[model samples]
Target: LLPGDEEPEVDLGRLLQTVYERAAYDLRVRYEEEPVPPLEPPFAEWAATLLREKGYRRR
Candidate 1:
């Protein structure tokens, strides 16, 4: 609220962009490889987990 006060220098938008881009890139790489499904939670649960990990939280 005072004059000459320096704001925070971090750019949160760019940071999240970088993170999302990396996740996308990794997903692409995984697509190129064979699908590896876990044996514990069953196929449906594993698929849901995969989607969640790739940032698909909801419709």
Candidate 2:
């Protein structure tokens, strides 16, 4: 569910499976024996900081 939204019935198992699949695909693209150096602070921390800077508070 989003931060502010109407609640609706959803399949939890399918939702989680979709999220997991997308994350796995993204990870493969990011760390598949890349020649370039990895980001200094890593993706999750960097994303959190960027979102916070943009005034996006976590629920």
Candidate 3:
């Protein structure tokens, strides 16, 4: 590890989710077989608001 270097703060949930997605095939992981679910409009809006509030969500 580089001296004095530090890990940047981030949303670990999203980061782990992305990593899992990329590794799913290699790991032989399978998702649920259930039919596609409807989008929760309010949840999406709430997430957006939370991200904006976090500031790191932008860039």
Candidate 4:
């Protein structure tokens, strides 16, 4: 409903959910296959903490 007239409708919750799912899926795939140098012991724990904070609790 800006310049051109069309429909007056929007679903913000659905949009946010779609974006979140896409981002989470991409992150999972990229991290699972990528190789990297050894990290300090704390790095693994940090990753777990971040994931949990994002509501990605591992199964």
lDDT of each: 0.64, 0.62, 0.59, 0.65
Model 3 Cα lDDT, one tens digit per residue, 1-59: 48898977899999988987888753562222211463388865565566558652452
Per-model TM-score, in order, reads 0.28, 0.30, 0.31, 0.34
What range of 10 consecutive residues in model 3 has the weakest lDDT sum? 29-38
- Residue 42 lDDT in candidate 3: 86
Cα-lDDT of candidate 3: 0.59
lDDT of 1 by residue, 10-45 (tens): 899999889879788656544333356534558656
lDDT of 1 at 35: 50
1-59 per-residue lDDT for model 4 (tens digits): 58888886779999887987978865664443222664576886676667667766551
What is the per-residue lDDT of model 2 for residues 1-59, given as tens digits with 9 covering 90 to 100?
78898899999999997997978864564332322555556775666566557655351
TM-score of 2: 0.30
Clashes of each: 0, 0, 0, 0
Per-residue lDDT for 57 in model 1?
39
Task: Quote the lDDT for 58 in model 1.
Answer: 42
Range of the 10 consecutive residues with the lowest summed lDDT in candidate 4: 29-38
TM-score-wise, the better of 3 and 4 is 4
